[model samples]
Target chain A: MTLVMAGAISHAPGITGREKMAPEDKKTRYYDACYRFRDHLWDQKPDALVLVSAEHFGNFFMDKMPTFCIGLADDYQGPIETEEFLNIPKTTIPGAPELARRIADVAMQEVDLGYSQEWSFDHGFMVPLAFLTPKWDLPIIPLNINCQVPPLAPLQRCHALGKALRKAIDAQPERIALIGCGGISHWPATPDSGKINEEWDRAFLEDFVANKTDRLLRYSNDEIYRDAGPGGQEVRTFITVAGAVEGHGGELWCYEAIPIFAVGCTVVNMDVAA
Target chain B: MSVYYLDKLMYQLNRDPMVQARYKEDREALLEEYRLTDEERQAVLDEDIGKLYSLGNQPQLLMHFAALVGYAWMDYIEAMRVGAEKYGEPQYQR
Candidate 1:
């Protein structure tokens, strides 16, 4: 049976420093929770990690944009100029066409979306990569979404897709893990951008950990984007992350609101029953 | 595709007066809308291809550009191997 693990931290310049763009110490200062959860991942050491994230700059350009671009590459790299373009590992993750095709088919059967067999990872996927998996040896199958632009995937659609991913993983023969990156109320423009929605945050956490997914998927894209910020839109990735967990109920891995640049540097661990 | 590359298209258009007319309008609009820092605004008006690419926004177009050039250059060779079997050989010879 394949094991899929997933999580996301919204883009808080604090996570990626504000003034100098100094990379945050994800291991300690930035994602303390991820570190704790990292132990569990280290233990599992799945042969491959399938990453799903939105493209801040890997598969977008002026004029035309794609809603979803899957990285079917031997590796990925961020633009050279940005500091977030740190040395993240390049992955040759197996893109089980049969599996990806099945997930896409299941999703399209339910939602209005497009599909592609090829794509690459961007800063949203890479910065975390620098901190999350830096070895550069592991293989990663990336799913890049069009979160920045509107007419994008709704929170419900992402949740449904995550559900589909779990179904796909179950069919796979190899052990697999998943990570969905992005979120926890943070703005990119203003210095005072990262707003901590503890009330909603806690409620979601409760619903997540209690396996009470009924309320979890009920939240709408408008509610989340309005509350989070246009950039906070990436929060839909969490729906997929939530869907990846075999069972519900998330343990508070760690939470921090580094307002210096407006991002909630929070991380949570979803315990999967062994 | 990166806007850096699109701006390159704009840069190539600087030689065309008509395209330059619209370019200036969209250029100013981009500055105001993106709330581009003075530095960003200045870089565009100054026509700095390198700085534009650095911002790294709307990168999907780069793929389009690569494809355009790829087809122009590689289509011939690729057509021989892949396309020939599918659409027959291209009659137009460079």
Candidate 2:
């Protein structure tokens, strides 16, 4: 059985390289929570961590949309600065071509799933890995979802797709854990721009961990706009995790609002029920 | 302004603290809490076109404000289109 753990967030200020944060205070609470989340994943000692996330123009463009993509490289590295991107060395771990084929086949029956041989790890995958791995032998499989485009998959579609991924992983017979990374609530424009929806953030975190997604998964873009804040757009990442963990039910591992990037960081642990 | 144009402008302005804060009273604190420099402070205050265009530290915000400006400028284009249709290009006929 695969142990699936995940989070939906912008960059937690304490973790993101964007700004400096004070230590030993509620202000640093997100960082404190991050450390605990890391310990939990490490304790699981799974054979590999399969991460699903969005890429910020790293492997795509406005010209085309690739619904699903897989990284088939021998190694992945990052946190690219203007001059250098921290590079790490590791086995690419097999891309699971058969599993990909099956998952893609299933998803296509429901929605579109694009397959790519080369996709790099962007911050969505890198940030959590930076903390979670801290240094480990297990490999990473990068799954990219197109949330930024006009023709984005519905929140419910992403969740169902994750359910497909669970079956795909089961077919592989490998010890695997899944991590969903993205957002809590963040505008990502000006540090001053995003309007953090405290009520929605708290509600989102609470509802997701409890595996109560019937309502969340149904929010159309129009409804999302009417009720959820603009930053609520990030909640799609959480929906995917809900699909992964909802079967067994998830426990809220941690939740924190880090103001640096105007992001909310949350970690969820699930012992998926068979 | 056309409703479509006004709606686009609203979306762009939505990313601005000036605009975002409009929805909530205490939004000013969120704006002030961030350590923005004096120049940025002034640029936002002035609604200076050049400063607005150049502000890239926050692409989402910068692009949003730029979009607002674009929407406003589009109104001028619309007016010109109406004039052209009425005057037939304002030709100098000998």
Question: DockQ winner among the candidates?
Answer: 2
Name the regions of candidate 1 deviating beyond 4 angstroms: A9-29, A79-81, A84-120, A190-192, B1-94
Candidate 1: interface RMSD equals: 20.1
Per-residue lDDT of B93 in model 1: 9
Give me the candidate number with maximum lDDT: 2
lDDT score at residue A94, model 2, on the 0-100 scale: 37
Candidate 2 local accuracy as lDDT?
A: 0.54
Candidate 2 per-residue lDDT, tens place, A9-114, comes to 3433224554344233644666556677777767767656677787655555444667666554555545322111223332223344444555456445655567
Task: Report how far residue A102 has shifted in candidate 1, in Å.
Answer: 7.5
Give the TM-score of each candidate.
Answer: 0.65, 0.67
